[model samples]
Target: MASMNDHPGERAAADPVKLIGVRETPLSVDEVFRAVGDDAAGGTVLFVGTVRDHDGGSSVDRLGYSCHPSAEAELRRVAEKVAANHPVRALAAVHRVGDLEIGDLAVVVAVSCPHRAEAFAACRALIDDLKREVPIWKHQTFSDGTEEWVGAC
Candidate 1:
């Protein structure tokens, strides 16, 4: 029987989550895309999330994102989970915090895998799990003098 430690490269291959962050500045799609580039990957998928003009049929005047101190760690956890479930060769994710106008990039995530379907599935799972599990909240001000905080719980 061969010990796993005999192959250090295989050990590193077990954990493919590369980059994870929460930034106060704007998010960059190109940066995230470049971070996940891999020579061994056959497919790379990138997903950019932007602030929209409206939500729930109401005009959004502006919005701000806030997060707990552990948000970055939580994001890493989500990315790791996605990598573990897929054949992820590389992965990167970043979310912006601060006031943002409509059409501003809010989040960027990318994944590279051995196949197109694997890349797509991993990228989708990364973003979806980050949104659902991260301790980030969005405060939206509506045009009609109303405001709401989302994902606060």
Candidate 2:
């Protein structure tokens, strides 16, 4: 655990969050996988979320993602929490917003740790927290012309 009196820069150096971002452009799995690369890490986990073809028995024609201004900060906070709870050597996460079609990548996250179990747990925590805590919203347009928005808040 980091001491409360520890300098922010020093703490960041000791436990680095390698990459964090919310982008309107397309996301890359290779980029995220590479970002969390660490020489000392024995295990790495990568997760990718994609826009699927259907939802709730309805065919999805397209999907759009939107977010509040504080979304990136919230994502960083989630990453920090995961890092604090695990032996994370490196971590990275990126989410895509704006218009998207079926099969488009929606999110990518990766974590590296000293062991495979730690890495898997940390990566799962990162994604779960981000989805629960962040203000990113998803809008789905069904083939029948119905639209819906989904988010925590």
TM-score of 2: 0.90
- lDDT by residue (4-91, candidate 1, tens digit) is 5544322224557777899998888888888887877888999999999899999999999999999999999888888888878899
Give a tens-digit lDDT track for model 2, residues 66-103: 99999999999999989988888899999999999899
- The residue-level lDDT of candidate 2 at 138 comes to 99
- Report the C-alpha displacement of residue 85, candidate 1, in angstroms: 0.9
Can you give the lDDT of residue 148 in candidate 2? 88
> Candidate 1's error at 49, in angstroms?
0.3
Residue 73 in model 2: lDDT: 94
TM-score for candidate 1, please give it. Answer: 0.90
Model 1 ranges off by over 4 Å: 1-14
What's the lDDT for residue 19 in model 2? 93
Estimated TM-score for each candidate: 0.90, 0.90
